[model samples]
Target: MAVLTERPAAPVRRRDRGARTLVNRFLGYAVLVFFALVFLYPFVIQLGNSLKTQEGAAANPLSPFPDPLTFAGFERIFAGTNFPLWLGNSLLVTVLVTLGRVFFDSLAGYALARLRFRGRAGLFAAVIAVMAVPGVVLLIPKFLVLNQLGIYNSYAGLIVPLIADAAGVFIMKQFFESIPVSVEEAARIDGASVFRTFWSVVLPMARPALITLTILSFQGSWNEFPHSLVSVQDPHLFTLPRGLADLVSGSLGKGTQYPLKLGAALLATIPVAVLFMIFQRYFVRGANEGADKG
Candidate 1:
């Protein structure tokens, strides 16, 4: 009874602001869902049509549900093609290349980041320059160099050129620079040699960067076609990508076998997809750290 009147009802502005925010959030979600559908649409179609008969796939190219599913395409992929051999080769090359990239790139990156040497700045600048060059332009030069080295049509050609990537080196270098120098100094104080310090002390802290590099190396080497095309002419040495390309482009005689090709493509994509899913956290962390360091 002291005031006998309720404070004037709350101002309308607060409710108005909240309504605007709600409207904005709804529009944002609408846009995100629309784009998600657009991007996922093709993968859905591929997966669905891969299960369909050739006739069914051709008739319903855009459909995401097959009327009747068949495994004939998958059966043909293993039985009618050199998929197993390609898989083996892809596994070998990807493993070797990933190992080499992670080791050599990290070594070079650490050198550039921590080691004092003449022309260190120049060397890093050269790495940056190499990154700027288009890969297509280097193909011819790479071919000539490989031919001269007498390893052109061998695994050496396939693995060696790819083992050291400027981008990987840059990524490792950036990450190494972000680590506090005091950590390495402490290792040094504790009687650790440079290599031991790097291998034991610093490398453990670089798991995020290493995982990022591994994913990149695996994906790049797995999907590599142009390098394999030029590096090895032997059908026995073909990787999954090269084999898949040959399969799609008139290798399977006569009319378009969309089901078989799509099936093979789908299988080829699964490994990388699985790897990404497994290490997505490390990849995101590496990217964020890289951004902050930059």
Candidate 2:
């Protein structure tokens, strides 16, 4: 019999494989860092320009360093403009809208998820359809309704229209469906009414979804511009975004006024940024939970 000696197996290229992986990881990280800087460059410019003199900002709007830094822009923001009023309105509207959305969205979500009612499926479908509709499409109708209701140019118009949204209801409903029905059934077995079960048992367990909704609602109301544009024309009723727009549109009159405008815009961005940073972990969890349910 011919001596059959299996040729030695080719040496595994483990070293080359490891080196390739290392190179790939480095490139991936490099690309990510590059994009991060690109994305953040505008904000960096915004900050730098906000601290610059008007002449300095105008000369070098793209510069990320302020030469002869000053606070005159911030001073002008408060002393010369209605920044304080806009801030107060934003806070009030944000808080009320967040609270209303959390309550109303959760109620609607639970009803759709667990309730046995006529048109339940159809209502849920309609809610989904509403989410698909571009909000701009509703602007004319929204204005018409608000005008008819005689609430235009008032806080009610600003606050009420934003209190609850189809998106919030959809988010809450998806999250609710992920929860085990047995949990609510147990509450019911102990004689909890439908509303009581929702309030005491279900809502408490839906903390992630609630936080997500609160953050979204707060951000939406804080940055609300189109709604404010259509709802209120009074300068006194202007929210931060609307006021910022007015500030940029020759409200301050002549000259670039770059520092003052950027400072005001920067101040407007802080609340939402801080809120997101504080609740970022919960927000991510909520988003993941919603995604998994979907």
Candidate 3:
């Protein structure tokens, strides 16, 4: 009698569970949307303020839209300053760094994750240890190294050290470890070389992780100021952040060139902004991947 009654109870329990799931999903989305706006509002203000004139921008720093749109700021960026040159430099550095991180970091990561060489564990441990080293503390050491290599004031110094990061390697290694071994095993059984298998088989499956690292590399190199500060003293070598810092620190003359400064920042931010907008799903996937791997 109890068994027969319990059969009907299954449907009732499932219906209640489905209702609870629906409510949870709705609440989750609501929280996400709210926080997204909160985090993103500053960029929105930057975009709007950049379009305002010098007076307008200074007067209304908090406004979301320019009262009267002015191209004066952008005009100054192009006409009065070597904005295009800095933009080009930033793009060049970002591309090379991102590519290097994606390739080298993944190779190191996969080796650390899968290969069973002597001292592999020690090497992986070293990479994690390196990641814990604070960036600011490395400032003096990096400068000394760059000077010793005679690449201190060159583009190479700015781009090379940033190419392969410890964090990227660690992230990739974690993701690689979480992946099923059967996939790599199948490729190996077909007589593929390790590099060939990794290049063709494993990396394809690591698309989410790769994109995440690429995006991080791009953002990091793009906003990099301290490295640029120590790497080169030449105005010609100034990336956007370096140039912007110069502008803010009275190099752009006495009063605030608010509009021009904001305009430059706006342009500088667009690439990462567009990337974040389009690859948002991958970002979420990457976050979840790290959580699972850890």
Per-model C-alpha lDDT, please?
0.88, 0.88, 0.88
Which ten residues in a row are the worst by lDDT in model 2?
A: 1-10
Q: Could you tell me the C-alpha RMSD of candidate 3 in Å?
A: 5.0
Q: Model 1 segments beyond 4 Å from truth?
A: 1-10, 253-255, 284-294
User: Positional deviation of 255 in candidate 1, in angstroms?
Assistant: 5.7
TM-score of 1: 0.89
lDDT of 3 by residue, 1-294 (tens): 767757756888878989999999999999999999899888888888888988888898899789899888899999999889899899999999999999999999999999989999889888878877888888889999999999999999989999998888988998899899998899999999999999999999998889889877888889898899888888898999998888788578757788888788888888877988998887676567557545
Q: Which stretches of candidate 3 lie over 4 Å from their true place?
A: 1-41, 285-294
Q: For this target, which candidate reaches the highest TM-score against the unseen true structure?
A: 2
Error of 1 at 160 (Å): 1.1
What TM-score against the true fold does each predicted structure earn? 0.89, 0.90, 0.82
| Displacement of the residue 45 alpha carbon in candidate 1, Å | 0.9
Question: How much is the lDDT of residue 190 in candidate 3?
Answer: 91
RMSD of candidates 1 onward, in order: 4.6, 4.8, 5.0
